[model samples]
Target: MTWTIAGSLAVVPAPTRTDLLAEPVAKALAALADPDAVGVAEIDPSLADTAAFCEAYGSPLEASANCVVVAGKRAGEVRFAAALVLATTRADVNGVIKRRLDVRKASFAPMDEAVSLTGMEYGGITPVGLPAEWPILLDRRVAEAPELVIGSGIRGSKLLISGAALAALPGAEVIEDLAR
Candidate 1:
Protein backbone atom coordinates (compact mmCIF):
# COMPACT_ATOMS: atom_id res chain seq x y z
CA MET A 1 0.00 0.00 0.00
CA THR A 2 1.10 3.55 -0.74
CA TRP A 3 -0.01 6.80 0.84
CA THR A 4 1.12 10.36 1.35
CA ILE A 5 1.58 12.45 4.45
CA ALA A 6 3.51 15.48 5.65
CA GLY A 7 2.50 17.42 2.51
CA SER A 8 4.82 15.87 -0.06
CA LEU A 9 6.26 12.59 1.22
CA ALA A 10 5.16 9.51 -0.61
CA VAL A 11 5.01 6.91 2.12
CA VAL A 12 5.28 3.19 1.53
CA PRO A 13 5.14 0.28 3.91
CA ALA A 14 8.32 0.38 5.95
CA PRO A 15 8.79 -3.37 5.74
CA THR A 16 8.87 -3.07 1.99
CA ARG A 17 11.61 -0.45 1.98
CA THR A 18 14.31 -1.98 4.13
CA ASP A 19 16.93 -0.61 1.79
CA LEU A 20 16.00 2.90 2.84
CA LEU A 21 16.53 2.18 6.54
CA ALA A 22 19.46 1.30 8.71
CA GLU A 23 19.86 -2.42 9.38
CA PRO A 24 18.60 -2.25 12.94
CA VAL A 25 15.59 -0.18 11.96
CA ALA A 26 14.75 -2.60 9.19
CA LYS A 27 14.95 -5.51 11.62
CA ALA A 28 12.80 -3.72 14.14
CA LEU A 29 10.21 -2.96 11.49
CA ALA A 30 9.89 -6.61 10.68
CA ALA A 31 9.35 -7.35 14.34
CA LEU A 32 6.48 -4.94 14.80
CA ALA A 33 3.02 -6.41 15.23
CA ASP A 34 1.81 -4.59 12.15
CA PRO A 35 4.82 -3.57 10.17
CA ASP A 36 2.78 -2.39 7.25
CA ALA A 37 1.12 0.21 9.41
CA VAL A 38 4.41 2.04 9.56
CA GLY A 39 5.48 4.04 6.54
CA VAL A 40 8.85 5.04 5.15
CA ALA A 41 9.84 7.97 2.96
CA GLU A 42 13.15 8.64 1.29
CA ILE A 43 14.67 12.09 1.30
CA ASP A 44 17.91 13.89 0.55
CA PRO A 45 20.48 12.90 3.16
CA SER A 46 21.71 16.50 3.50
CA LEU A 47 18.23 17.60 4.62
CA ALA A 48 17.78 15.00 7.35
CA ASP A 49 17.86 17.36 10.31
CA THR A 50 14.42 18.18 11.66
CA ALA A 51 14.25 21.86 10.79
CA ALA A 52 15.78 21.41 7.36
CA PHE A 53 13.76 18.32 6.56
CA CYS A 54 10.51 19.96 7.55
CA GLU A 55 11.19 23.08 5.55
CA ALA A 56 12.42 21.24 2.48
CA TYR A 57 9.75 18.54 2.50
CA GLY A 58 6.88 20.77 3.51
CA SER A 59 6.36 18.75 6.67
CA PRO A 60 5.22 20.63 9.74
CA LEU A 61 7.40 20.82 12.82
CA GLU A 62 4.45 19.88 14.95
CA ALA A 63 4.23 16.53 13.21
CA SER A 64 7.93 15.79 13.52
CA ALA A 65 9.37 14.08 16.59
CA ASN A 66 13.00 14.02 17.63
CA CYS A 67 14.69 11.15 19.42
CA VAL A 68 17.38 12.46 21.72
CA VAL A 69 19.98 10.26 23.34
CA VAL A 70 20.66 11.19 26.95
CA ALA A 71 23.15 9.95 29.48
CA GLY A 72 22.85 9.96 33.25
CA LYS A 73 25.43 8.83 35.75
CA ARG A 74 25.37 7.83 39.40
CA ALA A 75 28.15 6.33 41.48
CA GLY A 76 30.31 5.69 38.40
CA GLU A 77 27.56 3.77 36.70
CA VAL A 78 26.18 5.34 33.55
CA ARG A 79 22.73 4.95 32.12
CA PHE A 80 21.68 5.81 28.60
CA ALA A 81 18.18 6.37 27.31
CA ALA A 82 16.21 7.86 24.48
CA ALA A 83 13.75 10.72 24.88
CA LEU A 84 11.07 11.20 22.30
CA VAL A 85 9.55 14.64 22.02
CA LEU A 86 8.11 16.95 19.45
CA ALA A 87 10.54 19.02 17.44
CA THR A 88 8.84 22.18 18.63
CA THR A 89 9.61 21.40 22.29
CA ARG A 90 12.67 20.49 24.31
CA ALA A 91 13.13 17.48 26.54
CA ASP A 92 13.38 18.20 30.26
CA VAL A 93 16.69 16.42 30.60
CA ASN A 94 17.75 18.03 33.88
CA GLY A 95 14.36 17.76 35.44
CA VAL A 96 11.97 14.92 34.77
CA ILE A 97 14.53 12.79 32.94
CA LYS A 98 17.22 13.14 35.55
CA ARG A 99 14.74 12.17 38.21
CA ARG A 100 13.39 9.34 36.12
CA LEU A 101 16.84 7.88 35.63
CA ASP A 102 17.48 8.22 39.37
CA VAL A 103 20.68 10.10 38.64
CA ARG A 104 22.02 13.37 39.90
CA LYS A 105 22.48 14.76 36.42
CA ALA A 106 21.35 14.06 32.88
CA SER A 107 22.52 15.49 29.59
CA PHE A 108 22.68 14.78 25.91
CA ALA A 109 25.04 11.98 25.04
CA PRO A 110 28.08 12.66 22.90
CA MET A 111 27.47 12.33 19.17
CA ASP A 112 29.99 9.58 18.66
CA GLU A 113 28.74 7.54 21.60
CA ALA A 114 25.12 7.88 20.54
CA VAL A 115 25.78 6.83 16.97
CA SER A 116 28.13 4.02 17.87
CA LEU A 117 25.93 2.60 20.58
CA THR A 118 22.74 2.65 18.56
CA GLY A 119 24.28 1.53 15.29
CA MET A 120 22.53 4.43 13.63
CA GLU A 121 23.61 7.60 11.94
CA TYR A 122 24.31 10.74 13.97
CA GLY A 123 21.48 12.89 12.57
CA GLY A 124 18.97 10.06 12.33
CA ILE A 125 18.57 8.14 15.55
CA THR A 126 15.03 6.93 16.02
CA PRO A 127 13.43 5.24 19.00
CA VAL A 128 12.50 2.16 17.00
CA GLY A 129 15.96 0.60 16.90
CA LEU A 130 17.55 1.66 20.17
CA PRO A 131 19.22 -0.76 22.53
CA ALA A 132 16.70 -2.91 24.36
CA GLU A 133 18.16 -2.10 27.76
CA TRP A 134 17.60 1.60 27.40
CA PRO A 135 14.37 3.22 28.46
CA ILE A 136 12.41 5.04 25.79
CA LEU A 137 10.75 7.99 27.43
CA LEU A 138 7.88 9.32 25.41
CA ASP A 139 6.38 12.71 26.13
CA ARG A 140 2.65 12.48 26.72
CA ARG A 141 1.98 14.93 23.94
CA VAL A 142 3.90 12.78 21.52
CA ALA A 143 2.06 9.66 22.67
CA GLU A 144 -1.23 11.35 21.87
CA ALA A 145 -0.34 12.66 18.46
CA PRO A 146 -2.28 10.96 15.67
CA GLU A 147 0.73 10.71 13.39
CA LEU A 148 4.37 11.68 13.58
CA VAL A 149 7.34 11.78 11.24
CA ILE A 150 10.48 10.40 12.85
CA GLY A 151 13.96 9.33 11.83
CA SER A 152 14.53 6.00 10.13
CA GLY A 153 17.86 5.33 11.85
CA ILE A 154 19.52 6.68 8.73
CA ARG A 155 19.94 10.18 7.37
CA GLY A 156 18.37 9.37 4.04
CA SER A 157 14.86 8.44 5.13
CA LYS A 158 12.06 9.07 7.60
CA LEU A 159 9.41 6.94 9.20
CA LEU A 160 5.74 7.71 9.62
CA ILE A 161 4.15 6.03 12.60
CA SER A 162 1.22 6.50 14.90
CA GLY A 163 1.40 7.62 18.53
CA ALA A 164 -0.21 4.39 19.68
CA ALA A 165 2.38 2.30 17.91
CA LEU A 166 5.17 4.30 19.48
CA ALA A 167 3.68 3.98 22.93
CA ALA A 168 3.49 0.25 22.42
CA LEU A 169 7.14 -0.07 21.46
CA PRO A 170 9.45 -2.03 23.70
CA GLY A 171 10.53 -0.04 26.75
CA ALA A 172 8.39 2.93 25.84
CA GLU A 173 7.00 4.79 28.83
CA VAL A 174 4.63 7.70 28.46
CA ILE A 175 5.61 10.49 30.83
CA GLU A 176 3.82 13.68 31.63
CA ASP A 177 5.72 16.90 31.08
CA LEU A 178 8.70 15.10 29.64
CA ALA A 179 9.16 18.00 27.27
CA ARG A 180 8.55 21.72 27.38
Candidate 2:
Protein backbone atom coordinates (compact mmCIF):
# COMPACT_ATOMS: atom_id res chain seq x y z
CA MET A 1 0.00 0.00 0.00
CA THR A 2 1.17 3.48 -0.72
CA TRP A 3 1.89 5.57 2.38
CA THR A 4 0.31 8.96 2.41
CA ILE A 5 -0.03 11.70 5.02
CA ALA A 6 -3.40 12.10 6.71
CA GLY A 7 -4.42 14.99 4.51
CA SER A 8 -3.74 13.38 1.16
CA LEU A 9 -7.44 12.61 0.96
CA ALA A 10 -8.30 15.74 2.89
CA VAL A 11 -9.37 13.59 5.79
CA VAL A 12 -7.05 15.16 8.35
CA PRO A 13 -5.57 18.58 8.70
CA ALA A 14 -1.88 19.24 8.56
CA PRO A 15 -0.44 19.45 12.06
CA THR A 16 -0.31 23.05 13.13
CA ARG A 17 1.33 22.27 16.47
CA THR A 18 4.91 21.21 16.78
CA ASP A 19 5.32 17.80 18.45
CA LEU A 20 7.67 19.23 21.09
CA LEU A 21 4.83 21.29 22.50
CA ALA A 22 3.86 17.85 23.87
CA GLU A 23 6.86 16.73 26.00
CA PRO A 24 9.62 14.09 25.76
CA VAL A 25 8.56 13.81 22.13
CA ALA A 26 8.62 17.58 22.00
CA LYS A 27 12.23 17.78 23.10
CA ALA A 28 13.09 15.13 20.49
CA LEU A 29 11.30 17.06 17.77
CA ALA A 30 12.92 20.37 18.69
CA ALA A 31 15.84 19.60 16.44
CA LEU A 32 13.76 18.93 13.33
CA ALA A 33 11.98 22.26 13.35
CA ASP A 34 15.15 23.79 11.97
CA PRO A 35 15.77 23.38 8.22
CA ASP A 36 12.07 22.67 8.30
CA ALA A 37 13.17 19.04 7.98
CA VAL A 38 9.84 17.89 6.60
CA GLY A 39 6.12 18.27 6.86
CA VAL A 40 4.43 17.13 10.07
CA ALA A 41 0.88 15.87 10.55
CA GLU A 42 -1.14 15.76 13.76
CA ILE A 43 -3.50 12.91 14.46
CA ASP A 44 -5.77 11.82 17.31
CA PRO A 45 -3.84 12.24 20.53
CA SER A 46 -5.15 8.90 21.84
CA LEU A 47 -3.68 6.85 19.01
CA ALA A 48 -0.04 6.89 19.99
CA ASP A 49 0.57 3.17 19.85
CA THR A 50 2.80 2.22 16.92
CA ALA A 51 0.12 0.34 15.03
CA ALA A 52 -2.76 2.59 15.93
CA PHE A 53 -0.81 5.69 15.10
CA CYS A 54 0.02 4.37 11.66
CA GLU A 55 -3.46 3.05 10.89
CA ALA A 56 -5.06 6.30 11.98
CA TYR A 57 -2.70 8.12 9.67
CA GLY A 58 -3.07 5.50 6.87
CA SER A 59 0.52 4.29 6.99
CA PRO A 60 1.98 0.83 7.63
CA LEU A 61 4.15 -0.21 10.55
CA GLU A 62 7.00 -0.86 8.13
CA ALA A 63 6.64 2.69 7.01
CA SER A 64 7.00 3.88 10.60
CA ALA A 65 10.39 4.00 12.24
CA ASN A 66 10.85 4.01 16.01
CA CYS A 67 13.45 5.91 17.97
CA VAL A 68 14.69 4.72 21.31
CA VAL A 69 16.93 6.68 23.67
CA VAL A 70 19.07 4.57 25.95
CA ALA A 71 21.43 5.27 28.84
CA GLY A 72 24.47 3.07 29.20
CA LYS A 73 27.47 2.97 31.48
CA ARG A 74 30.91 2.87 29.93
CA ALA A 75 34.04 2.53 32.03
CA GLY A 76 32.25 4.06 35.03
CA GLU A 77 30.95 6.97 32.99
CA VAL A 78 27.24 6.96 32.24
CA ARG A 79 26.44 7.98 28.69
CA PHE A 80 23.25 8.47 26.74
CA ALA A 81 22.35 8.09 23.08
CA ALA A 82 19.43 7.46 20.75
CA ALA A 83 18.77 4.55 18.39
CA LEU A 84 16.71 4.73 15.24
CA VAL A 85 15.55 1.33 14.11
CA LEU A 86 12.77 -0.20 12.13
CA ALA A 87 9.54 -0.14 14.11
CA THR A 88 9.25 -3.86 13.40
CA THR A 89 12.81 -4.56 14.59
CA ARG A 90 13.78 -3.90 18.19
CA ALA A 91 17.02 -2.11 18.94
CA ASP A 92 19.90 -4.48 19.60
CA VAL A 93 20.39 -3.35 23.14
CA ASN A 94 22.49 -6.32 24.23
CA GLY A 95 24.71 -6.41 21.18
CA VAL A 96 25.04 -3.07 19.41
CA ILE A 97 24.43 -0.77 22.35
CA LYS A 98 26.55 -2.85 24.68
CA ARG A 99 29.53 -2.60 22.35
CA ARG A 100 28.86 0.99 21.40
CA LEU A 101 28.90 2.13 25.01
CA ASP A 102 31.58 -0.41 25.94
CA VAL A 103 29.39 -1.49 28.79
CA ARG A 104 28.67 -4.81 30.41
CA LYS A 105 24.94 -4.44 29.81
CA ALA A 106 22.63 -1.90 28.22
CA SER A 107 18.93 -1.39 27.77
CA PHE A 108 16.27 1.20 27.26
CA ALA A 109 16.77 4.27 29.34
CA PRO A 110 14.88 4.00 32.60
CA MET A 111 11.45 5.52 32.19
CA ASP A 112 11.96 8.09 34.92
CA GLU A 113 15.41 9.07 33.80
CA ALA A 114 14.43 9.13 30.15
CA VAL A 115 11.67 11.54 31.03
CA SER A 116 13.80 13.59 33.38
CA LEU A 117 16.84 13.85 31.17
CA THR A 118 15.10 14.37 27.83
CA GLY A 119 12.18 16.33 29.25
CA MET A 120 9.84 14.40 26.92
CA GLU A 121 6.76 12.47 27.84
CA TYR A 122 7.01 8.69 27.73
CA GLY A 123 5.72 7.18 24.43
CA GLY A 124 6.52 10.58 22.96
CA ILE A 125 10.28 10.45 22.90
CA THR A 126 12.10 10.67 19.56
CA PRO A 127 15.77 10.97 18.58
CA VAL A 128 15.29 14.56 17.57
CA GLY A 129 15.22 15.61 21.20
CA LEU A 130 18.53 14.09 22.30
CA PRO A 131 21.58 16.14 23.30
CA ALA A 132 23.87 17.07 20.43
CA GLU A 133 26.80 15.25 21.97
CA TRP A 134 24.98 11.93 21.80
CA PRO A 135 25.28 9.89 18.64
CA ILE A 136 22.37 8.33 16.72
CA LEU A 137 22.37 4.84 15.21
CA LEU A 138 20.06 4.54 12.21
CA ASP A 139 18.76 1.27 10.80
CA ARG A 140 19.61 1.09 7.10
CA ARG A 141 15.99 0.17 6.27
CA VAL A 142 14.68 3.26 7.98
CA ALA A 143 16.81 5.09 5.47
CA GLU A 144 14.87 3.54 2.58
CA ALA A 145 11.22 4.39 3.17
CA PRO A 146 10.25 7.09 0.72
CA GLU A 147 8.46 8.93 3.50
CA LEU A 148 8.32 8.12 7.19
CA VAL A 149 5.89 9.12 9.93
CA ILE A 150 7.80 9.47 13.12
CA GLY A 151 6.98 10.99 16.46
CA SER A 152 6.30 14.70 16.05
CA GLY A 153 8.60 14.53 18.83
CA ILE A 154 5.24 14.18 20.54
CA ARG A 155 2.66 11.44 20.93
CA GLY A 156 -0.03 13.81 19.77
CA SER A 157 1.52 14.08 16.33
CA LYS A 158 3.96 12.51 13.88
CA LEU A 159 6.37 14.07 11.43
CA LEU A 160 6.69 13.11 7.76
CA ILE A 161 10.12 13.07 6.17
CA SER A 162 11.93 10.99 3.63
CA GLY A 163 14.09 8.27 5.16
CA ALA A 164 17.09 10.06 3.71
CA ALA A 165 16.31 13.29 5.50
CA LEU A 166 15.81 11.52 8.80
CA ALA A 167 19.16 9.82 8.51
CA ALA A 168 20.94 13.05 7.64
CA LEU A 169 20.32 14.65 11.01
CA PRO A 170 23.44 15.59 12.90
CA GLY A 171 25.14 12.68 14.66
CA ALA A 172 23.26 10.11 12.57
CA GLU A 173 25.23 7.33 10.88
CA VAL A 174 23.88 4.37 8.97
CA ILE A 175 24.30 0.90 10.41
CA GLU A 176 23.38 -2.58 9.21
CA ASP A 177 21.22 -5.05 11.16
CA LEU A 178 21.08 -2.57 14.01
CA ALA A 179 17.97 -4.10 15.42
CA ARG A 180 17.04 -7.17 17.45
Candidate 3:
Protein backbone atom coordinates (compact mmCIF):
# COMPACT_ATOMS: atom_id res chain seq x y z
CA MET A 1 0.00 0.00 0.00
CA THR A 2 1.26 3.47 -0.89
CA TRP A 3 1.42 5.86 2.04
CA THR A 4 0.88 9.54 1.23
CA ILE A 5 2.05 10.54 4.70
CA ALA A 6 5.73 10.07 3.90
CA GLY A 7 7.78 13.19 4.49
CA SER A 8 11.45 13.27 3.50
CA LEU A 9 11.92 9.75 4.85
CA ALA A 10 11.63 6.66 2.68
CA VAL A 11 8.66 4.54 3.74
CA VAL A 12 8.90 0.81 3.25
CA PRO A 13 6.69 -2.14 4.07
CA ALA A 14 7.20 -2.82 7.80
CA PRO A 15 7.37 -6.60 7.40
CA THR A 16 10.28 -6.09 5.02
CA ARG A 17 12.08 -3.72 7.39
CA THR A 18 12.07 -5.59 10.69
CA ASP A 19 15.64 -4.41 11.23
CA LEU A 20 14.30 -0.91 11.74
CA LEU A 21 11.95 -2.03 14.50
CA ALA A 22 12.45 -3.14 18.05
CA GLU A 23 12.06 -6.89 18.57
CA PRO A 24 8.64 -6.67 20.14
CA VAL A 25 7.38 -4.33 17.44
CA ALA A 26 8.67 -6.57 14.68
CA LYS A 27 6.98 -9.57 16.22
CA ALA A 28 3.72 -7.69 16.60
CA LEU A 29 3.78 -6.48 13.00
CA ALA A 30 4.32 -9.99 11.74
CA ALA A 31 1.27 -11.13 13.66
CA LEU A 32 -1.00 -8.42 12.32
CA ALA A 33 -3.87 -9.57 10.12
CA ASP A 34 -2.67 -7.12 7.50
CA PRO A 35 0.95 -6.25 8.13
CA ASP A 36 1.14 -4.70 4.70
CA ALA A 37 -0.95 -1.84 6.00
CA VAL A 38 1.92 -0.62 8.13
CA GLY A 39 4.99 1.20 6.89
CA VAL A 40 8.37 1.85 8.45
CA ALA A 41 10.77 4.73 7.90
CA GLU A 42 14.36 5.19 9.01
CA ILE A 43 15.16 8.35 10.93
CA ASP A 44 17.95 10.04 12.84
CA PRO A 45 17.72 8.87 16.44
CA SER A 46 18.39 12.39 17.66
CA LEU A 47 15.30 13.63 15.81
CA ALA A 48 12.99 11.00 17.26
CA ASP A 49 11.22 13.49 19.45
CA THR A 50 7.96 14.71 17.94
CA ALA A 51 8.87 18.35 17.26
CA ALA A 52 12.32 17.57 15.93
CA PHE A 53 11.07 14.70 13.77
CA CYS A 54 8.25 16.68 12.22
CA GLU A 55 10.45 19.69 11.51
CA ALA A 56 13.35 17.69 10.11
CA TYR A 57 11.19 15.42 7.97
CA GLY A 58 8.68 18.03 6.77
CA SER A 59 5.78 16.08 8.34
CA PRO A 60 2.98 18.04 9.91
CA LEU A 61 2.86 17.98 13.70
CA GLU A 62 -0.85 17.13 13.63
CA ALA A 63 -0.10 13.92 11.74
CA SER A 64 2.20 12.65 14.44
CA ALA A 65 1.04 10.71 17.48
CA ASN A 66 2.68 10.08 20.84
CA CYS A 67 2.34 7.00 23.00
CA VAL A 68 2.78 7.63 26.71
CA VAL A 69 2.95 5.10 29.50
CA VAL A 70 1.00 5.71 32.67
CA ALA A 71 1.11 4.00 36.02
CA GLY A 72 -1.83 4.02 38.36
CA LYS A 73 -2.02 2.52 41.82
CA ARG A 74 -5.09 1.00 43.39
CA ALA A 75 -4.61 -0.22 46.94
CA GLY A 76 -1.08 -1.64 46.63
CA GLU A 77 -1.30 -2.86 43.07
CA VAL A 78 0.00 -0.86 40.12
CA ARG A 79 -1.58 -0.98 36.70
CA PHE A 80 0.22 0.22 33.60
CA ALA A 81 -1.39 1.42 30.41
CA ALA A 82 -0.38 3.08 27.15
CA ALA A 83 -2.16 6.21 25.99
CA LEU A 84 -2.11 7.26 22.34
CA VAL A 85 -2.75 10.93 21.69
CA LEU A 86 -2.06 13.44 18.97
CA ALA A 87 1.15 15.39 19.44
CA THR A 88 -0.93 18.56 19.69
CA THR A 89 -2.53 17.40 22.97
CA ARG A 90 -1.75 15.73 26.27
CA ALA A 91 -3.37 12.68 27.82
CA ASP A 92 -5.86 13.37 30.59
CA VAL A 93 -4.07 11.13 33.00
CA ASN A 94 -5.35 12.74 36.18
CA GLY A 95 -8.95 12.55 35.13
CA VAL A 96 -10.17 10.02 32.59
CA ILE A 97 -7.19 7.72 32.87
CA LYS A 98 -7.22 7.58 36.65
CA ARG A 99 -10.91 6.86 36.58
CA ARG A 100 -10.57 4.23 33.91
CA LEU A 101 -7.72 2.49 35.68
CA ASP A 102 -9.74 2.51 38.90
CA VAL A 103 -6.80 3.96 40.72
CA ARG A 104 -6.49 6.67 43.26
CA LYS A 105 -3.90 8.43 41.15
CA ALA A 106 -2.44 8.20 37.70
CA SER A 107 0.70 9.76 36.30
CA PHE A 108 3.18 9.23 33.52
CA ALA A 109 5.27 6.24 34.41
CA PRO A 110 8.98 6.72 35.10
CA MET A 111 11.09 6.58 31.96
CA ASP A 112 13.05 3.60 33.22
CA GLU A 113 9.94 1.70 34.21
CA ALA A 114 8.22 2.44 30.93
CA VAL A 115 11.19 1.41 28.84
CA SER A 116 11.86 -1.70 30.88
CA LEU A 117 8.28 -2.84 30.94
CA THR A 118 7.53 -2.24 27.28
CA GLY A 119 10.93 -3.32 25.99
CA MET A 120 11.00 -0.16 23.92
CA GLU A 121 13.31 2.81 24.06
CA TYR A 122 12.46 6.06 25.73
CA GLY A 123 10.86 8.53 23.25
CA GLY A 124 10.16 5.56 20.99
CA ILE A 125 7.41 3.66 22.78
CA THR A 126 4.39 2.66 20.67
CA PRO A 127 1.17 0.91 21.55
CA VAL A 128 1.60 -1.69 18.82
CA GLY A 129 3.62 -4.18 20.83
CA LEU A 130 2.76 -3.39 24.40
CA PRO A 131 2.38 -6.10 27.04
CA ALA A 132 -0.75 -8.10 26.37
CA GLU A 133 -2.26 -7.21 29.71
CA TRP A 134 -1.71 -3.51 29.42
CA PRO A 135 -4.57 -1.49 28.06
CA ILE A 136 -3.99 0.78 25.08
CA LEU A 137 -6.06 3.89 25.43
CA LEU A 138 -6.43 5.57 22.07
CA ASP A 139 -7.87 9.05 21.92
CA ARG A 140 -10.85 9.50 19.63
CA ARG A 141 -8.99 12.21 17.75
CA VAL A 142 -6.13 9.84 17.03
CA ALA A 143 -8.54 7.08 16.01
CA GLU A 144 -10.18 9.47 13.56
CA ALA A 145 -7.01 10.57 11.81
CA PRO A 146 -6.40 9.23 8.29
CA GLU A 147 -2.77 8.33 8.91
CA LEU A 148 -0.31 9.00 11.69
CA VAL A 149 3.41 8.81 12.27
CA ILE A 150 4.14 6.87 15.44
CA GLY A 151 7.21 5.38 17.04
CA SER A 152 8.67 2.12 15.71
CA GLY A 153 9.64 0.98 19.26
CA ILE A 154 13.13 2.21 18.36
CA ARG A 155 14.52 5.71 18.20
CA GLY A 156 16.05 5.31 14.77
CA SER A 157 12.77 4.71 12.97
CA LYS A 158 9.06 5.50 12.81
CA LEU A 159 5.89 3.65 11.87
CA LEU A 160 3.12 4.83 9.59
CA ILE A 161 -0.36 3.38 10.12
CA SER A 162 -3.99 4.29 9.87
CA GLY A 163 -6.06 5.21 12.92
CA ALA A 164 -8.41 2.32 12.28
CA ALA A 165 -5.57 -0.17 12.42
CA LEU A 166 -4.39 1.31 15.68
CA ALA A 167 -7.87 1.20 17.14
CA ALA A 168 -8.00 -2.47 16.25
CA LEU A 169 -4.80 -3.43 18.02
CA PRO A 170 -5.07 -6.00 20.75
CA GLY A 171 -6.27 -4.41 24.00
CA ALA A 172 -6.89 -1.05 22.33
CA GLU A 173 -9.94 0.91 23.38
CA VAL A 174 -11.04 4.13 21.71
CA ILE A 175 -11.97 6.60 24.40
CA GLU A 176 -13.49 9.99 23.88
CA ASP A 177 -11.71 12.83 25.73
CA LEU A 178 -8.72 10.63 26.37
CA ALA A 179 -6.58 13.61 25.49
CA ARG A 180 -6.89 17.33 26.05
Q: Evaluated with TM-score, which candidate comes out highest? A: 3
Better of 1 and 3 by lDDT: 3
Off by over 4 Å in 3: none
Score every model by TM-score.
Answer: 0.97, 0.82, 0.98
lDDT of all predictions, in order shown? 0.93, 0.69, 0.95
Candidate 1 vs candidate 3: the TM-score winner is 3
- Candidate 2 ranges with C-alpha deviation above 4 Å: 1-16, 19-34
Show where candidate 1 strays beyond 4 Å: 1-4
lDDT of 2 by residue, 47-150 (tens): 87788776665677777788888777877888887888878889888898778877887888888887787766677666665667878888888877677767
Which is better, 2 or 3, measured by TM-score?
3
Q: Model 1, 92-171: lDDT tens per residue?
A: 99999999999999999999999999999999999998999999999999999988999999999999999899999999
Residue 98 lDDT in candidate 1: 97
Taking all chains together, the TM-score of candidate 1 against the true structure is 0.97
Winning model by lDDT: 3
Q: Provide the lDDT at 126 for model 2.
A: 68
* Ranked candidates (lDDT, high to low): 3, 1, 2
lDDT of 3: 0.95
